[model samples]
Target: MEGLEIGLNGNLVDAETQQEGGRFFAADASSSNYILLQCKDVLTLEQKEELKRLHVTLLSYPAYNTYYCRYEPTELDEIRALPYINYANIYRPEFVTEAGLKDKLENSDEGHQPPEEKRYEVYISLHEDHRNRLEQIRQKIIQVLGIDPELVNADAFILRAKLQSHEIARVAGIDEVQRIEEIPRLALSNNHARVDLNLEYIIGAANSRLVVGGGLGQIIAIADTGVDDQHEALRGRVRVIEGSRNTDARGHGTHVAASAIGSGNSLEFGPIQGTAPFATVLSHVIVDNAGNITWSPLMFQRAYNREYGARIHSNSYNVSHAGIFQQRQYDGLAQDCDRMAICLPQLVILFSAGNSAPFKNVTSDGEIESQAAAKNVITVGACESTRPMTRNPLTYDYYVAVPIPGYLALNLAGNRDQMALFSSRGPTKNTNGGPDDRRIKPDVVAPGTVIYSAKSSQLDLTLPNILPGAIEAGVPNDGRWSYMNGTSMSTPLVAGCCATIRGRIALQCHNLARIPSVLVKAILINGTKWMVGTNQDSQGFGRVNLAKSMVCFSNHLGCGFWPKQESDFARMQMIQGQELKIRVPLPTANPYPDGITPRFSLTVTMCYLDYPDQSGLVDHLSLKVLQKTRLPDGTFPERYGNKLPGEPADNRNNVQKVIWDGISAPAPFQHPDPFRIYVRVERLARDAQFLHHFALAWHVEEMSRGDAQFDFWNERMPSTDARNRFMRKD
Candidate 1:
């Protein structure tokens, strides 16, 4: 009433709410399509059609002069206003207001406060030619918010409406509102049966038994607590998801869908595969069997009907801790699962990082959980392998339908590559509220202790409190197996080693569906064995090597990308210190001239995906390296005179990485230079594109011999179709 304010289009506009925090929503890049409200006003054109039926456009009737912003834009800080100027730009301050919300909205009551009906759910973002006038604005949002223009959804451009609360200011002053709020009420979701091939020999990939023909035409999914697809290591593979409920009755989604892509056609044990056992499972029950989890009903029930292909989901489940900051409702469901992984380009979502026991990198054990500490989901964590769990064969008589408990065991004692004191450590430091959630994360690590795979003889194979009489209670079991540990078995061994590195880039670089899950998460965190010196919050950017991420994606040795843009300004560029460079050339087909500085060992990574925007604008982007050799008295390499060596005017980290490790060689070849790799996409917060698509990944190698040497370069990969045209590398 008085100075109004509830304007996320629940009407009652005229500005007042910005005293400290935007009650429901608030934006300001010096006001883009204006939004600021205070509600319960003096209204009714059915409350302005319930503020245009909860999709509120621009609301300002008279009380338009209220500005108190020190920033309130979200969906993960793309941070804008550097000079969209207004509130006297004091050192570039966006907006900050108080003075007791301007003397309690200029001293209250311009009348009418009784008329509540409460029922909201909202999340509208329309305006793409108003989605072809969404059923004529869904019959004026059901004749002014009575709720039933078939519940108005507009199927994603963000629109989730449910109305009431006085029909939300008659649907927030619509002109096809580009933003609306309220939708964070998640209801939510483990592991073990084996160390899964001793976690494929602790991430070295079972010493190259590399069945490299991994899950072709990929498809993971698995959500959880339901995958029992007639388990004999999932003989019929599995699909479910349609209306979910394909029953698992708590066998824990058929042993986490046979530990990510299992299909060892079950005898119950030999090589207990999965980790993309020829990938393709979908599953997706969302924790039933009394585990009770609910992520927007299976992400809008498998996005209602169809269209979800290119996936890798596998979220070993965790939530209900919700503390260490970062929550735009789990970063708006991780920016809608990173807009379906940049629109499904080898999509990978993964999520574990929460066995929640140990913690470091400057304290706090209760941090990285929920949607696995959100922000574009990779998470993972849980290293293992000192080798111990090997039980199950006292003259074994393997399952001819179920009987042999023989020695009935599943050991995996933990000690190998270490770091599994429950595995869940990371700097994650606060996101969705962005700026600096520090980022490190469990981007790697694998082999959950005591691992084994596929088990769903249908409940009770154990767990009524570990080994208490080692199971027998009505065991009908079919293709049953055993063992269990955490970081939910190291996130499906990095989602089945990203489907065997996208099945070796679709069998030797034919370009496995254009390989890209951030360049297979930067070639598995730059082919980690440990990002060269651990404790990046307990070994992230380490472990999970998958045979050095399939020989660095078959010798392209760490990829790079920006590719997929066809609109909204193609290459989405906005470089500041300018330099999108690349020069990773060391194994130049063995061209001698060991001319120093070629001791090799580098790791890159870069990662990108942002555009749910609220505006923080320029988020730091960096990665530097320069060596252009020469000097042993031959002149040429100068320390950044015009810039190169560690060049940077900007660097904050979207997912940055840079390690050297070794550097000795230098005896000189009179004129041998070239090691450059500058990428710095700096811009504090001016905007033109808050990093649209980046995926850089690199690896240089040669680290002082004892086996750190990966690709001495050139091992045979490229083989395109229609008779050859592949030659493309930068």
Candidate 2:
């Protein structure tokens, strides 16, 4: 032997004895004797322990099957001689010698030893194969890392824990580990008037007792700080789940809940009813008393969907990080949300695009926050509420003066159609770590500036606000109602609208309680009217209009979608290299500007809840529409969803829309003209063999400049044999 080493216990060391931390080198050995060991496989716990006995310190396993180590020159042969070892090479230090390490250690407070490592709060995502064994894997981690039980979160799929930085590699070495990312801080990121949404027209047109058929029998869940169920506005409608507090200490949750389903309780707060006032709310308090989000969104989704039967989940919070102007990466938190959405196809999850506009430069585009960047959940942005700018002068002035160079301006928040200066915009980071692969976000915008909603009585009115003069602009001295501003307010409003869409579909389609979330999204997007004041990326398709969405469900409109087997309205399922075509009839009745002329426009939307992939490349479906008849120019017109008049099919989003604005098709007696449109859905990827389901919604109406109105009484429902054909191959 070149040299000999002994353990601290004074025994002659062998290659099999196990020890902890740094190993004892031979008395004459120095730090320069350190070497790197590359192995063919991950070391077993027993092997890791055995290496400590051979006077070798396993410093770290920085990469797969590789270890950085310090060892005695004599023990190098034994380590290299191991059957599993690939190579052992010297590890050189730039300038350090044994003297430097000794001097550094001797000056230490505890004498001759390195200081303790710092710990970090991290969110851990396990491999998909290990998802079902989450609890078992978590326990293994706890046992291996010696973690405190209190630091571990009770999540469904993803795991969150407090661990030292060095210990992270150990966890990554676990077979169940898929990705490791630093846990970014999460913060709250939302509403408007009923008139802006044209709710009155929708309610009156439906002739229902409440908005959007009163969102009958639908349950909307809200995950926020906490809700005060005792509040007069939300009193009888809010149900706080077990393990979640019902009291609103921070007050954010109460406002969010009320925005979604507060009954308005006219006896107390006049007519400030929520969008879907009749929908029941399942309140899940994810935030602590300090206003920090205590639970991951996946945890809330699991509880709300499985335990409470809430298919509509609204989230007002998203991950935040300093200097992170836009969430360019579809990080773990977003993946968690998307995973849940995929698992629960019936659940319509919504998240607020963050309120980080003031922090962005004029060149900034993808300012959407983490969880809000999820591909499945609908990300909502804020538009100026109809509320007069005078009511909140401070907020109005602040918006005009916000530091975003070319984006902020005076009177931006005064126009109901304008995008809010503080609302987050997006092309949701890039997917799979590529620059040109950005996805559009803020699927729709709603009123978020100076939105008036319920307030928590238990909250301290004296507390400071996050935004300048927010307390003065939002909270009143009485504390019964609040006038807040954020995408948070917008998100719940959309949630309520989603509930309304769900309820309306259930009533119209033979009580279809489990409407595919994609259908609801399709209906909602199909109804959106484009906003003139904002760019496409900033406002998405446009601000949501409930009246228009409900009109798509009206029997009069020549729109057809599925789950209505009675009317032959069925969704399409397809695999790779397959195409599904839906034929939609154009209303032939002369109910237009002229008694004998036909002038109409059509809108078609296709949506699907994509199957999640571990590689971040989700399933894609393309949508295209071709008119069966030639226009006056002697040419057949074709349109692709989200693309220009003749552009190629869109492959970037799960939802696609095509709008035919002004069409004066050939007469009813012309050749090849029953006046129908063929909508096609094509799958572009063959990554999986499972069948993918998609919903197609189409709307046709006579082009006229008039108030939002639809005569449903005289409307003709499509007959069972109305010749709407759906052709699909296996």
Highest lDDT scorer: 2
Query: How well does candidate 1 score on lDDT at residue 610?
Result: 42
For 421-481, candidate 2 gives per-residue lDDT tens digits of 7788887754321214467788999888777778788876554434332354545444578
Q: What TM-score would every model get versus the actual structure?
A: 0.34, 0.75
187: Cα error in model 1, Å: 12
lDDT of 1 by residue, 1-730 (tens): 2332212212232222332243423333333334333233223234334434434432222122222122223211122221221111101111211122223233434355532444455555444346456556767777766666656665434556676544544455553454455554432223232332223332232224434565666777777767778766677767776687766655656766787777664343345566567777777676544455656523633532347564567777665434433322223344455445545545667778766542223357334643565545588877764434334321112111245342224222455466755566765543222133245566777776555566666565333322211122112123366555667666776787776665655555442334556656766666667534456677766776555544444334323333322341234365444556665554333332233134555566666654333211124456665566656887543232112354643232355566655545542222233556665555423233444555665655544343543333322322222112221110
Alpha carbon deviation, residue 220, candidate 2 (Å) = 1.2
How does each model score on lDDT? 0.49, 0.63
Candidate 1 differs from the real structure by a C-alpha RMSD in angstroms, to one decimal, of 20.9
| TM-score quality measure for candidate 1 | 0.34
